[model samples]
Target: MVEAALFDLGGVIVVGPWEGFATYERENGLPEGLIRRINSTDSDTNAWARMERGEIGLEEFAAAFEGEALALGYRVDGMAVLNGLSGELRPEVAEAVRRCSERLKTGLLTNNYSPMASSERSAELAEVMGWFDVVVESSVLGVRKPDPAFYTMACEALDVAPSACVFLDDLGVNLKPARAMGMTTIKVVDPDEALAELEAVVGFSLRG
Candidate 1:
């Protein structure tokens, strides 16, 4: 039986920041979908993965991103761009996490960077993450998901074997490694459906 549930913060627990990127792109006079191009390009040496892995600090990341934008003939403020991309918490998901935490142990497993320490963001994050029994952030751990080590670290911190935990993430790529490591995994889409799927796996009603 699953003794704990691990959740990804962005996309899973909160509405993703895609809208923010759309706004940023529009304001910068860049072609629509520039963010997608940057994200999909292998040539873009500074991707979110590097930041998530703690391989680069925020200032370095912003500078590299700005350099890339300039090289592409897109002049814009990279810090403002990144701030726009950070997500907002979903109240329903926060409530679900609280209910789950009260019934069974719940934890957060997010691939995030140092900007999470911002006072404005921290207060918002605390309200959502406070519901979890253990919160594992990539920036703090110096490791990221899809890497077995990160998953192992989360399992260790939660004091649960991989098989005893149900892990939920919006990205299929992130969930694959966790499933391979013996954790029950859910790819979140619809929040209610996600809760149902999680309940089925863990054999507990998250709604109290």
Candidate 2:
């Protein structure tokens, strides 16, 4: 039986500000999908992973990510892509989290940068993250999603077995590790559909 639910912060819990890159793509005359190109780089050695693991600073990430984008024939201001991450909470997902908390343990598992990047954003996000019983932030833990150990750490933090948890993330790559660990997984492309899937798995209404 599933005793816990795990959520990914940026894309799953809140809408990521993808418009910033849409605007950038329009103005720069670069073809669409530049930001994704930067993000889809080699995960282990990419600046994104390094920054989230607290091994590199934001400026370094910007520079390195830009270089990677250039190599892909897509030029973008990497800082803009980074800034685009601050998106509003998806109300449907938030309500589902509350309901899930009532029926099962909830956790916030995010691959994010250090608090030093933005004290204000960090402080504000912490208030909303209070819904979760356990929050495994990559910056704090120096580990990130897609790493088996990161998933294990989250399960340990929530004091639950991986087999008893259901995890959700927008990216399939992130969900793969959880599913491999025997945790049921959901890829959250559409909030309503994802919640509906969660409802099916947990046998409860998470809609509010």
Candidate 3:
């Protein structure tokens, strides 16, 4: 009965930036998770949120995020922290997307910041993005996940009802709204396990 499969780009389809954050923390001698703590403190109104919503440019975000960290008694470099967001793609997840696209609608729902320049995009990423039937980015929509409006927009884009969608995200916060709206939700902690669960729902083999 699932007509669409919705996925989150970071943490689910691709490797997440947590490892980068940890490395940054170790190199800077900052307290562990200090950057994440700052971002989560006023999540809805934080600099990270504003940047992802495309309300501010990268330079502005760097200053504002650094200021926020300083307010928390930590002198973290926001620009360096932002560098942690880039991660390699996960092939298994990408393959799953291709498989899902063969039979059902696939949507890429990502909360991401606008690239500083158009040249920041890569051919590889562009190719992977093509696999999605619909792509909804928070930077373009002015709404991010955990906001039901974002999920609603994605479903509407795919022309599917929420009850007929299966959503996957690494964050429970992002998945909660979708679940409440009647979508089947999966939290992707381990790629293999998450794909296993997806196979059960879609009744298809995502991994070869």
Candidate 4:
């Protein structure tokens, strides 16, 4: 039986900005997949992981990201790119999180940058976050998803064994590691399906 529930923020609690890359591409007149190429070329050179790890400040992170984009032929507004990558909360998933939080221990485990707290739009998401028992944001914790240390920190914070936690993440890459750590995992492709899967494991309906 599960003792706790852990959720990822982007693509799970909220719908991510699906058009971010396209928008940047359109603005910069870059060919399709340029962003992917950049990502592939320098996996650890970008500001994202460092920002999430709290190793760099927001301004520094933005400057580094913008510099990288400029090098990639994308002369774009860095803040715009960051804002474009975020979107409104997913109501179904938010409701499910609310329901779960009311009945059992709940936590949020997300890979995010430091600027999230300063974004005005983040206040909207904060309302939903207030419902969680523990919030393990990578920006604050200096750890990110797909890393065993991140999952270990979350498990420790919630006072639950990895095997007793049900973790939901939108990315299979992130979920794979959590599963390997003995946490029951769900890859959230569809909110309804995700809730159904959680209901199956937790033996309670989160839809209502």
Candidate 5:
């Protein structure tokens, strides 16, 4: 039985990187897949990986990422790429979070920048985040998703076994480790579909 529901903040809770990437591509006339390539690269040495871990600052990340993209035959604005990390909250997802909180332990397991760096988008998102019983931020923890320890820490913080928690994330790569550790994983592609899947897993109605 699932006692806790773990969620990813960016793609799972809000419109994120990909949406920003689309906007950047359109504005710059650059080839698509620039941000994708940057994020999908080797996690250990990639600029995005470093930034998300709080190992590097935003200014350094912008320059480092821009340099990498330049070698790939296009130039992208680093700040523009960074801007895609935050997005508007989905109302339905917010409602689902409150619903989940009523019956289960909910956690926010997000690979994000440091709290000092990421500004609150609005009162809504800040409040939605507050609904989670535990928030495991990668920047604060010095670890990013796909790292096994990150998953372990989230479970520990929530005080639930991996098997008793359902983890939701937009990235398949991030979900792999959780699945390996005996947690049920949900890939959140569309808001409605993902929430429906969550309802089925935890045997509760999140639609309210």
Candidate 6:
């Protein structure tokens, strides 16, 4: 039986900021996915990875990211990409998380940097964080997704074996390691569909 449900924050719980990126791209006349390209190149050692791992601050990341972009022959605005990181919460996901916490160990595993200031967190987000039994952040942990250590830390925190957990994440890359470790992985494209898949795995209704 699944003993825990692990969720990703940016894409799984809240609306992903892809639309923001799209808008920024259109406004800047940059080619579509220019930011994504820079992020993916040398992904593990890139500015983004460093920031998420808490090895660099936002301003340092922006400078390093600009250098990476220039190396790729694009004059990308790293700060603009960071500005587009805001995502709206999905109420349905919050409801599902609340329900999951009632029945199983629930965790939020996210590759995110620490908030530069306390004001970065809102009341709604604080409430959502309460629904999770454990919240594992890459910046705090010094390790991020796709790193087996990250998954292991979450599993250990929940006191569940990988085979006894289900993890939901938006990126297949992030899900790959967890799946390999024997967790049932759901790649979340549509929130409803992902919740349905979770329901099937955990034998519970997640949607209202």
Candidate 5 is scored at a TM of 0.95
Q: What is the C-alpha RMSD of each candidate to the true structure, in Å?
A: 2.7, 2.2, 1.5, 2.4, 1.5, 1.4
**By how many angstroms RMSD does model 5 differ from the true structure?**
1.5
- Indicate the worst ten consecutive residues by lDDT in candidate 5: 112-121
> How much RMSD separates candidate 1 from the native structure?
2.7
**What stretches of model 1 exceed 4 Å from their correct place?**
43-47, 70-76, 115-119, 122-125
RMSD of 3: 1.5
- Candidate 4 on 156-183: residue-level lDDT in tens? 9999999999999877878998898898
For all candidates, what are the clash counts? 0, 0, 0, 0, 0, 0
lDDT of 2: 0.83
Give lDDT tens digits, candidate 6, residues 1-208: 9999999988878878687888888998888988878789999999999999999998999999999989878787888888988889888989899999999999999998784224376778778888898888899889999899999999999899999999999999999999999999999999999998999999988886
Q: Candidate 6, residue 81: CA error in Å? A: 1.3
> Model 2, residue 22: displacement in angstroms?
2.8
lDDT score of model 1? 0.78
Q: Write the per-residue lDDT of candidate 3 for residues 51-158, one digit (tens) a residue.
A: 999999989999999899788787877888887888888889989999999999999998999732242656677777888988898898999998999999998899
Candidate 6 TM-score to native: 0.96
Candidates in order have lDDT scores of: 0.78, 0.83, 0.89, 0.80, 0.86, 0.89
- For candidate 5, write residues 56-101 as lDDT tens digits: 9999999999988887878788987776666778889888888889
Worst 10 residues of 1 by lDDT: 39-48
Which digits, one per residue and each the tens of the lDDT, describe model 2 over residues 31-147? 777676677778788988889999998899899988888788766687877776677767788888888888899998888886523455554455557778987888888888889
How far out, in Å, is residue 117 in model 1?
Answer: 5.8
